[model samples]
Target: MDYIHLNEMEFYGYHGVFAEETKLGQRFRLTLSLAVDLKQAGETDELKQTVHYGEVYGLCKDVVEGEPKKLLEAVAEQLASRVMEDFPLIKGVRVLLVKPDPPIPGYYKSVAVELTRGIFV
Candidate 1:
């Protein structure tokens, strides 16, 4: 299998457990690794033979900005599901959703949720 990785994608979003957090919004970073068979594309040298990163990025942005969720787990799940649904060639994905500089009083730089989905090899 081959992999296409998109790392440290940062976006500003409104998602949190607190009402103020939701209203104020925060920055979220996403890192994703998509697993797929790239042999066909490598051999054929055709765009149609592989997953398009531009398309994937657009889909991810839509998912990120669409609505606010209370939990990062929920966001990760939805994003993973969407990736599978949108790109049939991908066998699976590893998603990391990070909340940087959260509105916490204590010393916390960020919080993150990492998830892997789809069938195992």
Candidate 2:
């Protein structure tokens, strides 16, 4: 299967269990991988035949920046669902949401959640 990857998307969002964390906000990075067959798009050479990456980006941005969720797992799951729902051609999708510089006691680089969804229902 052919795949398209969108990586290292950054967004400033207010999402945390702590009050200060929510009020101050932090940086989040999202990466998306979509698996699909591009036969129609390749043959026709038409934009409509393939998945609209711009739309996917916009939707991801909207979801990531829209609401404050305590867990990145929820964000990742929601993103996976939206991608599959919006793009019918995609056979599977993987979503990763990373939180950089989390407010933890020790030194930690980041925390993230990875989710995968298949198109078949």
Candidate 3:
């Protein structure tokens, strides 16, 4: 098994439970890992034989920057499901979503949610 990872991809979006949060918007970071068999691509040296990371990045960007969701879990879920559906070659996917500035009373760095989807075969 081989992994393709996109770490700390940033986006600005309106996604939160509070009305103020939705209106003001904030920065979010995402990390995505795709599991696949790289034997064919490595041997053949063909782009088509492996997952196209550029396309995967575009898909992640679209999910992060598209519709607003009340929870980071929803965002992560949607991204993982979409990736599995769109890229059938990928056996599994892991998504990590981070909100650098959460709407909270205390001083904290960030809040995050991690989700994994699909089956390994």
Task: State TM-scores per candidate.
Answer: 0.94, 0.92, 0.95
What's the lDDT for candidate 1?
0.89
lDDT by residue for model 1 (14-80), tens: 8889988799888889999999999999999999999999898888888777799999999999999
Model 3: number of clashes? Answer: 0
Report every candidate's CA lDDT: 0.89, 0.87, 0.90
lDDT string for model 3 (21-93, tens) is 7899999999988899999999999998999998998998898888999999998999999999999899999
Off by over 4 Å in 2: 119-121
Off by over 4 Å in 3: none
Candidate that beats the other on TM-score, 1 or 2, i.e. the better one: 1
Off by over 4 Å in 1: none
- CA RMSD for every model? 1.2, 2.0, 1.3
User: Candidate 3 — which pairs collide?
Assistant: none
State candidate 3's TM-score: 0.95
Q: Ten consecutive residues with minimal summed lDDT in candidate 1?
A: 101-110
* Residue 46 displacement in candidate 3 (angstroms): 0.4
Clash count for each candidate, listed in order shown:
0, 0, 0
